[model samples]
Target: MNIRVNGEKIELSSTVKVIEDLLVFFELQERLVIVEQNREIVTKEEYQSTKLGDGDEIELVHFVGGG
Candidate 1:
């Protein structure tokens, strides 16, 4: 399947079916990160239930400390 990640087009395996699973696949399951799918913010509780489709766009933002 093809999905746009952070404005970059990429291809992934078909096994990546849901939003939550994708996070795990990318090794970004930590709660400190925020995920936006198709322009909507996805809650941590809903990540597991959020489904992803081909041509969908996903954005992941992580917190950093530098002050």
Candidate 2:
């Protein structure tokens, strides 16, 4: 399916179906980030079951350490 990720248009891989899968697909499983899908904030608990479809908008915000 085609999804817009952080303003970039890209096609989701065939093996990706859920938010969790997408994270792993991008090697972000262990990263500290917040995922927003279609303008809705997706909680960590929802990642496993959140279904991704065509035309979806996904934004990933990574957390950075600061002094």
Question: Which candidate wins on TM-score?
Answer: 2
Off by over 4 Å in 1: none
| Candidate 2 positional error at 5, Å | 0.5
Q: Which digits, one per residue and each the tens of the lDDT, describe model 2 over residues 1-67? A: 9999899999987889999998998788899879999999999999999999999999998877889
lDDT of 1 by residue, 10-51 (tens): 898888888888888888886587889999999888988899
TM value for model 2: 0.90
Number of the top lDDT candidate: 2
Specify the poorest-scoring 10-residue window by lDDT in model 2: 24-33
After superposition, candidate 2 runs with Cα above 4 Å error? none
Model 2, CA-based lDDT? 0.92
